[model samples]
Target: MGRFITVEPGINIFVEDINPAGRKTIFFIHGWPLNHNQFEYQYDVLPAMGYRCVSMDWRGYGNSDKPITGYGFDRLADDLRIVVGALQLKDFTLAGHSTGGAIAIRYMARHQGFGVNKLVLIDAAAPSSVDKQTANEFITATLNDRPNMLHNLTNMFFFQLITGPFANWFMQMGLQAAGYATAAIMATLRDENVYSELQKIVVPTLIVHGVHDKIVPFAKGQETSKLIKGSQLVPFQYSGHGPFWEERERFNQLLIQFVG
Candidate 1:
């Protein structure tokens, strides 16, 4: 169900392809510093419901080869395009979370939404969501002390009370990534503006955001929805940055409803 795919000559991306026989397909992209493992909760349920869930650990994260370069949105989005072509994925629902959502925005514009029928943005960081100053501070923390930075990240990740062990597990995923890749992604979040990219999304789009999200505030979600014409915005009342985990059941239901 999982394998390493050669996205380029030397770069291989880890892909978790499940339930290949399912009627519908969902291609997932994880957020900053996380991997496909972040979608564990969704993967547990979606496949059983006749959904073919596919996720990849983009370069420098998870089981993927961590090259120092190609961390920018252009290269990242190109990697996605290559993967889609390699997988022969067509008419699939493209879903992205946080920074992944920003990359997804770039993909829509850069590749003309290639092979994508529907789009889903989960607590996406986009359209100038975070200012330059905060990004610089976060980059400083990531470079100087990644462990503590990830620890603090976990604290902001959820509104629900997660067990200590669960938090540790989440932090471990971030640790698996390369330090440069992690910091480079934050720099992308800082320097890149995806407002024009958002306007280019022409597919049926869904925006799911946590009302209490401190990382990428609820207002960004609201603003994102407005930018994408005809996009639907749904708020998770009891979630933080990670609505998919904090209010998982509701999140799963919303995904099912939206994808349907």
Candidate 2:
């Protein structure tokens, strides 16, 4: 159910479309330095509940084409626009995690939320959560020692105990991405501000953030919720940056209730 879609000339994004016959669709965009496969648990359960689960690996990550340039949020959002149009999606729920959530916000502002009816931001990196200094440190660390940076990031991803092997596997997802692209995206996270974009969102939004999240502080989610009128904020007390996996059951159930 996965295919390479040509979003632009010389660039093909890897898209995974599951349970195509389902009544409703939830399109997922993953966080930074990881691909669509990051939502493995959700993909396993949603399709069985009569929901079509669609996910795509943005360029320079996972199975997608890794180009040298075009890592800006504007261009990334544009890529999403094309893919949605190609799939003929309408009124689908758009779910984005971390950096993907920021890009999704940009898409809402830039494309006017073209095919999306609802928005879900999970541990999103927005509302000026990541400061410039920290982002610069990350970019420097990534350029200097990429493996160690990813290793440490994996350790900070979840509050629950994750096995050593599992941590390695998760870190590998970051390794799969291009080094320059990873840095470029981090730069976008550092330089770009999404507060105005968040205010422009008109669809019903669900903001799910881990109360103990180290990557994106819970206060940022609060700020994002305030900016987007009528957006609901849900805090996962036991999780860290990745509530979708750390608290998969509740996360999936919340998605079901909101998307329904």
Candidate 3:
């Protein structure tokens, strides 16, 4: 149910296509330092709920071509355009997590949500500026010690205390992400401002965030809800950065209700 779709001359995007014949499609964009596999859970659940689930790693992450350039949000948005065109996707609901969330916003702002009918953001890192002190510190830490920063980030994003096979699973996925993408993409992301785009989104939008999200604080979610005219915000009150994984059943139930 998955294959690589060529985005351009040399770029091939690896897409996980579930329920190939489902009437509606949901193109998923994963976060930084991770591939489309982050939505592995959704792949299993969404299709069964009568929706086609499609996800791809950004150009430089996962099994996609790791080109030397095109790591910025603008390029990321372009990549989505290429994928949708290649796949002939329509009336699709765009869902993005973390960095992917910001990319989805850019896709709307830059392209004006052409074929997309709805939007979903899961603990997105948006409305951030590169000039912010917090972002600058993160950039510094990522530059100075990438591995250490990733390790700390994993713990913070998942939960304060990670244990068992779940912890191992999460760590391995994070490790497999391209270091180049992780390092280079972060700076490009920090330079963007999605609040205006949020305000412009007229399609039904769902903003999902973990109340305990440390990477993209809960306040960011609240602000995003406020900015997006009719956007709805759902908080995973007892989870961290990844509510899809942390609260699978609840998240899926809510997502199904929203997308259906």
Candidate 3 lDDT, tens digit per residue, 1-260?
76888877888878778887997888889987788888878887888878899888888788787777788888889989888887888889999998899999999988889789999999988766334676666667777886677667677887545575766676666666566666678778666667677777889999999999878889899998888888899989878999988898899888888888
- Tell how far residue 192 is off in model 2, in angstroms: 0.7
Per-model CA lDDT versus the true structure: 0.92, 0.92, 0.82
Clashing pairs in 3: none
Residues 85-181, model 2: lDDT tens digits: 8889999999999999998999999999999999999999888746889889989989999999998898888899999888987998899999988
Q: TM-score: which is higher, 2 or 3?
A: 2
C-alpha displacement of 67 in model 1, angstroms? 0.7
RMSD of 2: 0.9
Q: What is the lDDT of candidate 2?
A: 0.92
Model 2, which residues run further than 4 Å from truth? none
- After superposing candidate 3, which stretches have Cα over 4 Å from the reference? 129-145
lDDT of 1 by residue, 1-260 (tens): 99888877999999999998988999999998899999999999999999999999989999999998898888999999988998899999999999999989999999999999999999998877568898888899999999999999999889989999999999999999999899888888888878988888989999999999999999999999999999999999999999999999999998998888
Clash pairs (backbone) in predicted model 1? none
Count clashing residue pairs per candidate.
0, 0, 0
Better of 1 and 3 by TM-score: 1
